[model samples]
Target chain A: MAVLLLADVNDGALATDAVAKALSAVKGLGEVHILVAGTSAAAAAEAAKLDGAAKVLHADDAAYDHGMAEATAALIVSLAGGYSHIAAAATAFSKNVLPRAAALLDVMVISDVTAVVDADTFERPIYAGNAIQTVKSSDAKKVLTVRTASFNAAATSGSAAVEKVSATADASLSKWVEDKVAASDRPELTSAGIVVSGGRGVGSQSDFALIEKLADKLGAAVGASRAAVDSGYAPNDWQVGQTGKVVAPTLYVAVGISGAIQHLAGMKDSKVIVAINKDEEAPIFQVADYGLVADLFNAVPEMIEKL
Target chain B: MKVLVPVKRVIDYNVKVRVKADGSGVDLANVKMSMNPFDEIAVEEAIRLKEKGIATEVVVVSIGVKQAQETLRTALAMGADRAILIEATADVHTDIEPLAVAKLLAGVVKEEAPGLVLCGKQAIDNDMNATGQMLSALLGWSQATFASELAIEGDTAKVTREVDGGLQTIAVKMPAIVTVDLRLNEPRYASLPNIMKAKAKPLAAKTPADYGVDVAPRLSVVKTVEPAGRKAGVKVGSIDELIAKLKDEAGVI
Candidate 1:
């Protein structure tokens, strides 16, 4: 049985790290085939180079340009007959697309899979990572969304054969109007080696600059507690928590964060955690590898200058 | 136009869940249960649409145990016109799979043909963000997920979605599904007067059999276990010590 791995395309190129990480998860299941469905030939070229993939199925079409769930799900369903498993990176893009495909296929999707115990069995986090549930799917075809952070990215070395796939009929349900993504050279929050995150205690929107400056100094990504994002101190994409993006990096720095259980659910997997807050009794200190009882407003500036 | 909002009853967000000793599942006994936080935001958005005259009525639905009636009343107290409680499972620990829930909701949608179906992006309990998207697929409707800003314009909706990179704006035709994000709006608390008024509001109870959708589990739970906890680490005296430990001891930076 072969596994169909969907490759994520971004900015007319392959989302290399995301696709590689997703590939790592499915490679263990069976013969891995990468599906590159977008308006980019370069993305297909990139997918054809992933080491473990046996083949790259490329569908170059304008219908897939915006990555609409309807179009992608239709294409996946059209090609679902041959594969035993259909998988993609558990991201917002795939999160919106995969379940729909699963419903259309009359199967259940194992979302946010952290481990592949076997072809039919898997492990996933439930209750915001408070508990882990091992699930075994009984459906004929398995649909999955792989949590990219749990596995290492697949290296690019082997050359897999590229096969052309025809685009399916568009559902014509949604349209892309505009996307407002603030350009930043900093590494993405989910994959960064280090993440410097702020909380509501960081004060207003202007005071948030201290956290960003520290992240820049450390060459890390900027993140925020749900409180900081809800308070308008940070953008929605900057949120890192149970409801937002889950990140597991080499080093995670929490400044002024009280470490609510929801906040801890997202970052507890980091190898090293650092907490700086005026409140000595803050719960964040409990998990931090290095806890510094200090005011973030003053400590952040000093750390940035010294670094 | 009418708006349909689906909510879920889950363990309250404030309580820290504990895995049962036998590995069956999280201990739900004596646990506080409430409407999922994201679904609360969804109900609030539907009510706002009704108040703005964009919608003529707001209907809320929940598919779970009979006690989910409490969750529906909460939505009614918040300003929903009515509710439907589809009692699917008797066991509290048996969480209904998203595929079944979506199929049942599709049945409900066919019966009550609302112009829009608004729901939480994901329930906080299962953390399975699939129902709304699956429902859209079964019904063949447009979907705009992770919406931070949404406006109804003529026959279409202009939605600003929170994506991995940043915010994305999309135009979806009517009869769509919009799963709300946290920043959509601050959900309002039920007032004392509204709480009193909610008891008299219509709440119809049904079963999964009524919709001809089986609530059987397709995925078997092999085991449930607590996630490995992080060991407590040392507290540093100052910033210099912290940076030194990260660089020298941890080799992270």
Candidate 2:
């Protein structure tokens, strides 16, 4: 009947701009409903303020605090009867949750959709964004994971009514342990306005400071290529690639990074791309808006000094 | 305590993929195919579990074209105790959606009754990171997606997941499905002798009908095309020039 969207919550509020972008994705399909399934009511309240949503469904529960896929997916499936389309931002959160709900509903999920062609047709990147596939689903209900970068964020200018949802999703099969999330003063990689990334050229773990110094100079988030992460030059969370987090920031600076196709899939959509590397033949130069053929060790420090 | 791992045959990660000139799909003909990089990690993790005495056997399965047998053989060489190739499709282009694959795997899980199932978080070809989560749902079991670190203790598994912000650890009951991420562990290379030994290992060929699962296409491909390429811009000489371009020309700063 309506489109149900799972809200991405942070602490007690809507997480970043992802939900607003997801709202933009599900807006014209049907009656837009935002489902705030979390441990806090503040997130539901924030969802109610989103302009496009017709209503906010709040399912406040402790089991959802950790955002466990099992409980969250069960909650979505319990409310599946009232919606024709179920969607969420294609982050690690919803990626872990939505497909479970889709399988429970006996429907196929169109993961990381970049375009909504009508209600059933969607465009998604396949083969690490080297090829774009437009697919048409024949399922009764369409389950989608919206690639938020593909759409603009919906404005927050509405006072949609909030309804309470009483549902018990047993999460007895799983238990939340602990999170070792890096608590940084720097901007979050996915939501930052600018991102500075490093690669194997950044060299050892200690040498990643050059990339961080530049990121700090620009007040940007720090990111890394799969090469850097695999080499232990950076943490796994800092990876930016097809298998990693995707970002479409306004400014993306690649420091000593070779632009592998998988790496390009993550940040090729950036408005301004700056590549600082010694190797002129690196594929990153092809996509760079500003290419500097210089050693990043010297160039980054100099840039930091200039800034 | 057998650990089941599902591997997919995909275009090698090292190979640059090319979209078909006709724009129907990616050209798979004459392309180098290998076990998905992530699934190789899964197979390696399963074998590690057996080596650690946490699992008694490592069983690997691949659901795809007949060519996928090569992918399974690679897994067997990597140390899987046995292999199963479910020939789901004849055409290379007929990409069976995750829902169908999960259903078929769920059937295998019922028959094998492994203590755990480890799979790649997503396939390299489709980039659909849904199978493990879907399979967990179909089995009505717990799931830990994007797992980077996993440890089995008694009847539970403590998995450290690679989430957006950071690593989140969770403990799931046994007979769970764990979808692995990039940082899980380095996949080992199949040694020459092991590769030879793998050829003698028990390899079984099965069909979707054997599992009583319908392998039907739910999504129709409208078309596939190469993404718009970004052109190389003018190279700036100095830091000042780069800063000037960002502030004056681009205004992104």
Q: Pick the candidate with the highest DockQ.
A: 2
What does candidate 1 score on TM?
Answer: 0.99
Which residues of candidate 2, in runs, are more than 4 Å off?
Answer: none
In the range A21-98, model 1's lDDT, one tens digit per residue, is 999998988999999888788889889889999999988888887788888999999999999999999988899999
Per-candidate TM-scores read 0.99, 0.98
When summed lDDT is taken over every stretch of 10 residues in candidate 1 chain B, the lowest stretch is B230-239
Taken over the whole model, the C-alpha lDDT of each candidate is 0.92, 0.92
- Tens-digit lDDT track for model 2 on B1-253? 9999999999998898999988889999988999999899999899888888889999999998999989988999999999999999999977888999999999999999999999999999999899999999999999999999999899899999998888899999987999999888899999999999999999899999999888888899999999988899989998899999999999998
What docking grade applies to model 1? high
RMSD of 1: 1.0
Off by over 4 Å in 1: none
Q: Which digits, one per residue and each the tens of the lDDT, describe model 2 over residues A1-307?
A: 6999998875566784899899998898999999998778788888888888999999988888889989999999989898999999999999999999999999999999999989999999999999999999999999999998888888889899999999797979999998887789999888889999999998899999888988998999999999999899999889999988899999999998989988999999999999999999999999999999998888988899898
| Residue pairs whose backbone atoms clash in candidate 1 | none
Q: What are the candidates' individual DockQ scores?
A: 0.87, 0.89
At residue A245, give the lDDT of candidate 1: 84
